[model samples]
Target: MAYNDNDGDFPGETSTAREELRAEAREVLCRLVGREDADFHPGQFEAIEALVADRRRALVVQRTGWGKSAVYFVASLLLRARGAGPTLIVSPLLALMRDQVSAAARAGVRAEAINSANATEWDQIRERLAADTVDVLLVSPERLNNPQFRDVQLPDLIRRTGMLVVDEAHCISDWGHDFRPDYRRIRDLIAQLPGAGDRRVPVLATTATANERVVQDVAEQLGVAGADGSGEVFVLRGPLARSSLRLGVLRMPSPASRLAWLLTHLGSLPGSGIVYALTVSAAEDTARALRDAGHEVVSYTGRTDPEQRAELEQALKDNRVKALVATSALGMGFDKPDLGFVVHLGAPSSPVAYYQQVGRAGRATDHADVLLLPGTEDREIWRYFATTSMPDEHRARAVLGELEAAGKPLSVPALETRVDLKRTPLELLLKVLAVDGAVERTQGGWQRTAQPWTYDGERYGRVAQARLAEEKLMLDYENTSGCRMEFLSHVLDDPEAAPCGRCDNCAGPWFPTGIDETAKGSASKALGRVGVPIEPRRSWPSGMDRLGVPLKGRIPEESQVAEGRAVARLTDLGWGGRLRTLFTITEGGVQDAPVEQDLLQGAVQVLASWEWAERPIAVVSVPSRSRPQLVGSFAEGIARIGRLPYLGSLELVDGGPRGESGGNSAFRLASVWRMFSVPEELASQLASARESGQHGPVLLIDDRTDSRWTLTEAGRVLRGAGASGVLPFVLALNG
Candidate 1:
């Protein structure tokens, strides 16, 4: 059989030829892999064809068990035969690397891994690579970070590296489901490689759970732009549905009852499966209890020995271990297609985490169950895990202090010492804080996460508190929600038309039916307030305005607006207008009113009335190309303020050039800060600034740049705090 590329221009010939080629390719792959017939879904085959003919770098987001690895394997063989150079596969897990290498060897292709597995024979592997005897090299991100690897002359030996593949590329994004700081540096390494200059080496990124942002981040990080544009990026819709897997929520009245339910379920569930415990000790103790109950059980956690982990993985694969109770560590890279069940003994901190853990079941084919056993103490445990040790105020102050002292990159250890916390807690706190732009980690040490704060402590604290509260509330929602599957799906932003009928809530008679979506909307509306209005007609006529606040009836430009006059006019109107508008209102009888009040009362009220108040705002604060440092500083300020109550819901918006350049920009201190500043603070004089649903109160930190802050209803409320113009307020700083 023969195949025609998808890029063909003639429809009839393209269709006929492509069919023939696909048949030929399938036969070749089946023969190569020793399979009777290559079994794959339609979606999987289409993805393979797209990748084969793709001109630009591409990403394959096939769901687990969709034969993504097979696509690459076939592509690798074809590319090598066509003299495209050896393929370089970068994977995060050693086990996965080993599996691919073994499969390749079976297909009569030369494959080798340069990891700890071959530590004793590293020189031999290097020799094989240098001699061009290896067809593919499976490596880890850590290996690429090695200084010796950076200095190596292997680029000359492997001058024609065909394809660069990054598996689980979402790790490049700090906000990804799984974040690894080291992954952020992979862009640099890719940039320095040959063939990755003007035209980047063809890159293939693969992941199962990457969201839109993550997909973009992966493409940028791997120097592959426009790869996902052709529907080549497959996203399997709908929740994982398996009827054989019993969905159960065991609500234990007490710890004793919870333990009893766990034991009963573990004993009764047939086939091997995972039992996820909330803590390390819980996992171990539960495993011990199961062992005592005459079941072959093993426990795994962060502290588990490497050898033990290997043993457990092998045992599970071989069906020797009946059950494995573990923390979240085991779910990441484990691919057991026939997992019978996944029992969560307690609530995970976030719905994303829960979905990931539950997804491990029925990966290859649907016939598994996910059991959520929420004990009375599970809520408390989840809270403990979600809550940051440092208050937002303390974190903001500490971050600023560190930045002032170091003036350079500082590692986590150094920051811990300065912040006066134990290493583990401090590290976790820093990671959380970093998400909100409170602090940033560098080669040296952690620095202030956001731009240097021009605002006082109270303002900074408000922003921080808002952010922390939102994170905690999200966690709380997960713990308390009645529909576990729905909650998980919501967090993932999956738009399934209907709920999974197989979930615990859906299957049970007690499923929550009375909960109306409108009820939530009503509650939000009831709590929201409308702000005073700034008559637009009165505020805009001013020839010049500082902030466009109406003076008399006209707004003035900053050049003409006096600070004192602007403040007086805003106070008298019980609202704040732009400085420019306020100047006009004071100088001329243009019937000027407060711009802040008009914006708050009008924009916020409209948003709230339209029920778009809760929609997440995309905050873009990166300055134009001319002002890079200001972009960074502004981003930092945004991130710092993103942690506040009314501000934390905003999404960081990035609009940088595509590919590795964009990915690298995401990690830059300034870029991160800008990304974190989606929900900025608004000036107080806007009457409706405090109105619920108005998307306002956003602040851009770069004073020199033309920064625009759009406010949401929540943001308006925060902005209303600056009713008196004398309250020197930055747009988002405590608002």
Candidate 2:
């Protein structure tokens, strides 16, 4: 359905040249697929023609399995045959790089990759590039900014590169769901290619998940069309609809019920594929439950060790596991052509992102099932991730000011001391600032750039609004009466969108919607299981002295708190919802209420299961300005149940905790250091309790433990007051 633009005059548009390139491309294509009769798909030859013959930058917006990789692989061979230098590909994932390198071998083209995982091969790859033996070289987008790679090898590659390909090209655009600041470096890479017309380094950018906005944004950003209209880019776009996909949604009442549906019906679907979750804890917890049910499954998340991730991915590829319960981190660049189905335990925030994930299935098969079991907590988790990632102006300014004042490079840890942002968000903020020209990542760490930057509040606000709108659209997709495929097509601006007559809306539920009581009970029990141990901190945070706190290295053993217990995580499947409700109801301002009956019972169960060396004889609560009554009553209830003395809360003095939540560890420690002291009566009792060491350990309790600094400081105060030992307990762990 693509109309030939023929709007620009460039090299190799001649009929003779086109005919010859087409014939040669078909030969390479046949080799790629191991089929002597194989030929280009509708847009593959045209895309290759655009890149090789015309020597033009091109954007191919096609569905997955539409031969996007084939076009580039074939084009790279053709360009190499023409005496062009190596094709340098900017891929976004190591899995993609691995797959690309292997695929290139089918066509007998040499390909190599240098990533964080293969640091030892950097030398060999550099030698191959110098020897002009590598036909295609793949690397992550983040690698473009590496101090050594940028200064040492990038310049030579840029000067002699034949063609450049950006896999998962949507990462470069802000409008895309999986946007990354490192991807913006592709613009700079393209700029440095150095040539015009026939001598130009023809570029190819490919993706399956780009919408119209993402398409246009990427096209503009990749220099497909310059702002001054000096260059032209050939764009080949096709429909996003997939006939192989049979989309459906199965709604469940609660998280337990949704998980129960999976436990009962997963094997009934089809072959091995993914079960996506919205958070890491949910992914890990769900995997454990599935495995406990005797399913051959494993969890893949951001927390999964890098080497193990590759093995897990291979396991799914070989169909050794039933499925990998994973987060969105498992997405992008993973290729499994004949995957049977993809299930979501909860809905992703955007339908566009959902399409990208579900598209993973049925790639090489005639049919694959895609189902969603929507949960009530889906939107809340979506909003948490959406808002937390946005860069703050105050934090941005603080980072920039420190870099400017230092007059030299500053590492991330050093910056943590001067700025309050956590490692993840702070790194993200630095990337955003780097893209905006306010700072640059250099040898030691980061340095302020000479370029000026102004905070764009309006732009950030608009993006946040877009995310909210997308969240609403995701809800609509969950309950829609229209064709689900067509709805997704329109969401992604697919021109050929039409009712497939295959979804639940069109055909009245093609999937099984029943779960037996046994399955539900198993799932409920798995979710109901609670109690995560809290590991006590052994050392004080660095740079604490700068915050007017005298602490360094390891904490004194006499003052260190013992290992504690948390009832559950805020994102846990079992006790998470009740705990979330507990905290959310009291989030806006200070409020006082006793612990609810159900949660109190859950806490008791945690205590019963806890293996203690000695039973505590006293309970002391941390003073909570926001939840005094809750913490106080919870402590008092524990004392009443255990027959222990109910000592008062440690005193809050010297203007209590200096900063808000989400600060770095250094600031968090500084905020709580010396902020608590043993009250007179509590100290008197603690003194007598430890005089003969007959009172045993004191149970320290709080509503939540964030940063764990408050508990550390409070325990230190109690130990100084003569308690033999301190034991900490909390309702939730705010990871």
* lDDT tens digits by residue: candidate 2, 405-515: 999999998898899878888998898898887898888999999999898888788877877788889999998999999999988888788999998899889988889
The local distance difference test score of model 2 is: 0.85
Residue 666 Cα positional deviation in candidate 2, in Å, after optimal superposition: 0.6
| lDDT to native, each model | 0.50, 0.85
User: How many clashing pairs does model 2 include?
Assistant: 0
- Residue 48 in model 1: shift from native, Å? 2.8
- For model 1, how does the per-residue alpha-carbon lDDT over 1-735 read when each residue is reduced to its tens digit? 111122223223357657765775676578555887665544444444544544335566544565567766776766666566677887887667766787788776788887766688778878887777878888876665443553463354235676667777766765465666556656655554454332334556676666556666666666522333422232323233233444555554543344555555555565678988777756765676667656798998888876678778879878898878888878656777788878877766555566667777776545676776665555445443544333355654665687667777676544543554444656655554554455655545566644543334464455446445435544554444365555544554444424556656666732221223433343223222222221111122121122122223432221121111011122111121132232332343433222243333332343333322233232223233433443344334434334422222233356532221111111221222223222334332233444444453233222121111211111222223332111011221100
Best by TM-score: 2
Off by over 4 Å in 1: 1-17, 31-34, 116-118, 153-159, 189-200, 220-246, 386-490, 509-735
